[model samples]
Target chain A: MTASRFSPRRLAATFSLGLALASGAAFAANEQYFPLQSYRVGPYAAGGTGFFGGFIDYMQLINARDGGVNGVKLTWSECETEYVVEKGVECYERLKKGLNGAPAAATNPLSVGIAYATLERSTADKIPLITINHGRTDSTDGSVFPYVFPLQLNPYSEVSAIVNYIGQKAGGLDKLKGKKIVTLYHGSPYGKETIPILDILAKKYGFSVTHIEVPHPGTEQQSQWLNIRRIKPEWVILRGWGVMNPVALKTAAKTGFPADRVIGNIWSNSEDDAAPAGDAAKGFISITTHPAGTDFPVLKDIDKQVVKAGKGNLQDPKRFGNVYYNLGVVNGILNVEAVRIAQAKFGKRPLSGEEVRWGFEHLNIDNKRLQELGAVGLVQNLKLSCADHEGGGAVRFQQWDGARWKVISDWVQADRALLRPIIEKSAAAYAKEKGITPRNCAKEG
Target chain B: MDFFLEVLIGGLLAGVMYSMVAIGFVLIFKASGVFNFAQGSMVLFAALTFVSLLERGFAFWSAFAATLASMLVLAWAIERGVLRHLVNRPPITLFMATLGVSFIIEGLAQLLWGAQVHGLELGIKDEPLEFGGVLLSSFDLFAAGTAAALVLALSLLFSRTRIGLSLRAVADDPLAALSVGIRLQRIWGVVWAVAGFVSLVAGLLWGARLGVQFSLSLVVLKALPVLIIGGFSSIGGAIVGGLIVGASEKLAEVYVGPLIGDGLENWFPYVLALLFLLVRPAGLFGERAIERV
Candidate 1:
């Protein structure tokens, strides 16, 4: 039984069989993959858990009910990021390498800061960095960001939509002339992205803009509120998140500022944000990309097919209607749809990371398809091309009615013709700094 | 002038919270000559326990009682298990041990209750109490009142009761108290347990003001200035010191925070405390001791 006594031909055959077995296991591991970098432990866990749960639950529903995306079983693994950028990067590095030597098709970092930090690596890796609703607003220049895809409307477009709503409310765009608008923003990159757009708009509309910053992990904001009181702007757009949202609302109530005059970004518009301030946050307006409430057809389908079957992550199905929860579901749906599109090209089999990028780049969701999926309430017709990353800057306004948010404005598309040049210039400058080239989108067009 | 007055009131109110935490440090130091760094973590632990129980559908009173009972058990266990073993150890060893305890408590809290920030509704209204032209949150007023009452109760207990007398004897000299038939072990246990309850009350008030999170443990740093300004062993000093530090820091942030990048609130008090320490190490109300060799 010694190796020296054994025949060389037999040994070689045994080794080949072992190699074949290992390769078989590797192929088996590559069936379907999506990596989730989550933060279920940290200060932002309140928002994180809701979004992560929704993302996971929707994936689970798709896998269990539809038998995976186009017959390729959808599989995912979550790594805790703790809302820290370094930990998020670490998680990405660990998870991106994938199981059994198969690379992950896509990654949802969830945090805007983490997304921004990992944007470069995603492009280099040729894996789609799907920042569903947040990231560097300039990354919407798909030509420059080739692999980085902000699936939903970017912050700049969202701001434009908000301002458009404000203009409409003030009778017309001319009414904004000589009006003073203040932006009370959280002191971070997420908060800072809105400033340039607001400043540009202020100049164009003959209005004045005031920029006040509230530091991150914001618990104390008395002075910032005091300054806001002194300024007495006609409108205040809040870019604050977490505890900062309620604190701002409570402070505004104390200062006798009309709650209706105060507006929040989509991140700040949530049941968790409003519950803390209670009545003070009532009537507060916020820009929304999707309609709130779980009455949508997609949600009903999910409830019937997923939860009713006792296979959903939601402890309470009612939470599916929350601003963030709904946002998460929408994000999940987009990710799934992208995978389906990839399947159409790469066959009804599990697509690779590069193939998923193709799926994201060529997504086309018409109104008819949206209606069929019961997501008519969630989003408008969205189509992404090689040169255009944002798909389109379409959003609406919603107002809080003490307990819930109700849509108050129709879908308003941002002036993409005006924004394209700006996005390109900024994205090119970023590319220059990073020593990268814009992807050639002429062929795709 | 009105702004100055307003700032002062806010500072004093904030000071009451600092003192509440500082008093816990002062009590432990007085009884055992050790600074308990775990005081802040104890606050977080107690607050999280109370909030988690309440969220799980426990009655407010039941949760409160359960939290207090748990804290008492914790204090007794720590005293018997760790502190009692290290009674004759150096002050640095005790400090390091407390720091270790802080981490252990923090991890245990996260393990027991997931790391989501819980809203600690003290079942108290957060409305501002208007007085003429000035206004203050009712929560702040309650906090100030509760801290004062607790301090008074501790003072009365230390001065009026026989057990208090025995406790004071042990604090003055454990060896002498042992010779005089005072049950040194029991006295130490009672003091630690009482201090644990005080830490719980302090934690709840602070947590109520700023929703309960693991970061609530850092609130103990706010109490350090109090211990520095007031002597380490004096209870009244801890209260007054906390008030001075809290008020001064708030006022500084109002006047000077704009000049800086707005994080002065975190460090200004420590700077003032350090300056005061350099000027008067024994503190205002600290006992002036003379060593004869």
Candidate 2:
């Protein structure tokens, strides 16, 4: 009787309208998704902003310049992690859940600590974790970490590249015999990762390695340098971040350590990091995945299309072709290409998380394509597969010339013959702990 | 031996800084019988103001003068606005009020200067002065000299001046002093103003050394051990306590920190202070008092 009293026609009309809206929202949600777990505040905010700016600018460029990838309309949302692991995890959960109309297709946790934490979860979610150049070295095992893709060189590869450069500079690998290499590292997971690789290399090359761990966000290290002075290490590999890099350089300069002998990791090498040390860091060689400077065509395009068009996220465009920004651009291009690759398989349309994962797993970028994309100066040929997430372990040595970084070495790939077994063993052990079987690459095909 | 000597000197220099801030705490506590937890925040605020003003194109001396003037105003406002209302409140209430004041000052400092560490160069050379294989930084020397002069001056003021006599009278017995025509409120205000001045000096020195940052409040924790070690009521004790804590921590970091891991320098001072507190509850120079029920 109550239902009869209520206008049945009006109720039906209202219900239909609601259903239509909900379905429309659901359809929009299935379209595309991009989740950005960013660190816009904290100790590393300077580096974070540059990279995040590049990422956002590229995404905007995609929307404005290309009218979305294959007309599916690219959608993205950012959650700030503040460079804290717990907050990063929270951002991952929040961003992955998505809004009413958009769901997260891929996650780019722009922090090493965050990447380490999310590596396991990304595997479970099957959501591709595009760790550009910083994350767990073991995640390079694509068979174990099916969804975790460290696009370029990890710490292991970078250190290998640095040591390789050092070897070359010293005339040959035989010259490293009986040499003392000190690793003055920022005492964190990020800094600690380099030690094992260095240690392994030390054992193999018959070199003595002394690891001096500097505390997080290091501001004081006089005693560490003093010890280094007493020991008189032949070379110092600085695996520091934030203020630690410059402080180390300054201390090394004071202690009369040859600036040329101090080699910094990718994270430790930046114009901001180098500028503070000034002449002290003049000859400080740093291993880089991408060359630093704004002379690249890709950066010019970013300046013209993104910045000039009022879509630029960078406050200062001079920081456009810096280390982290270039890394971000490379990451952006990789992400776009993955989507394009996925589209090739599925259809000429917006790809879902699963489709994107497939795209990332099978991405193949040759030298010509890289050059065509204006990413030639930044990165070389990268090909990802189901069994190898890192694609290759290639990096170049760049020396800081007081004001700018100049490339001193050509592209060098890590000896895969040495790394493959290590990666496999680590990945297998990890998979066993998690009760996961390595995904069969042949079966996937 | 040389390394130990260097560390000891560094520690002592650092300790002087702790003492300067602790002295402010001691002065406020001695006068009001309430612990001023806001002393470190005051130091940070003063440093921030000085640096900010300097950064905004104000000449160094002008900025310094403006900072002192601002601190004087802050001290006056705190005495009139907060302390005046809480004069009759319990010691715990006053303590809590100071903590609240600390948070407010922090928020205001952030609002005024933003949450970025500003390099505060006081134009004092920081290069080490070498002497017979012993090296000591110029800033450390300046700090030690300034702290010694300040302490000596404060001791003279308390011993010889009429206002100091009134302050001591107020500290000894507020009710009796008021009956004897000593304005307790005015004396308290002057003491607070002096404490504020001490905070400003400490802030400028400390800020110049470490770069002005929001974590500047942690420096207050460095003073707490000093307060506990030196007897909260004794100005001389504050300086002594600071020296002990600072020297011990620096030495511990060099000799003991590496044994545990890095970053022990930050926590060693607190641990040492805790140990001292366990042994000396009333602190080294605290006056023995008998309560009349």
Give chain A TM for each model in order. 0.92, 0.91
| lDDT: worst 10-residue window of model 2 chain A | A96-105
Residue lDDT tens for model 2, A203-230: 9988899888776556556567766766
lDDT (Cα, tens digit) per residue for candidate 2, span B1-293: 87678778767877888898899998988888989989878997898899889878999999989998988888998899899998779999999999999888876876676544456666676555777787676767898999999999899989999999998998888889889999877988899889988988988877665556554565787788888888999999998898898788767767787688666766776777677778877789986566999
Report the Cα interface RMSD of each model, rounded to 1 decimal. 3.2, 4.2
TM-score of each: 0.87, 0.82
List residue ranges in candidate 2 displaced over 4 A: A1-31, A253-260, A271-285, A290-292, A309-311, A314-327, A348-350, A396-416, B14-59, B62-129, B138-238, B257-263, B285-293
Worst 10 residues of 1 chain A by lDDT: A217-226
| Candidate 1: Cα lDDT at A427 | 91
The C-alpha RMSD of each candidate to the native structure, in angstroms, is 4.5, 5.3
Q: Which residue pairs does candidate 2 place in steric collision?
A: none
Residue A103 displacement in candidate 2 (angstroms): 2.0
**Can you give the lDDT of residue B3 in candidate 2?**
68
Residues B1-293 of candidate 1 have per-residue lDDT tens digits of 65566567767877887889888888888878878888988998899899889988999899989999989888888888888888788999999998898777777877787666666667667666667666676777888899889989999999999988987888888789899999766887888788889978987887766667766777777788888898888989988898898788767766787677554666777788788778887887876656789
Residue A35 C-alpha lDDT in model 1: 82
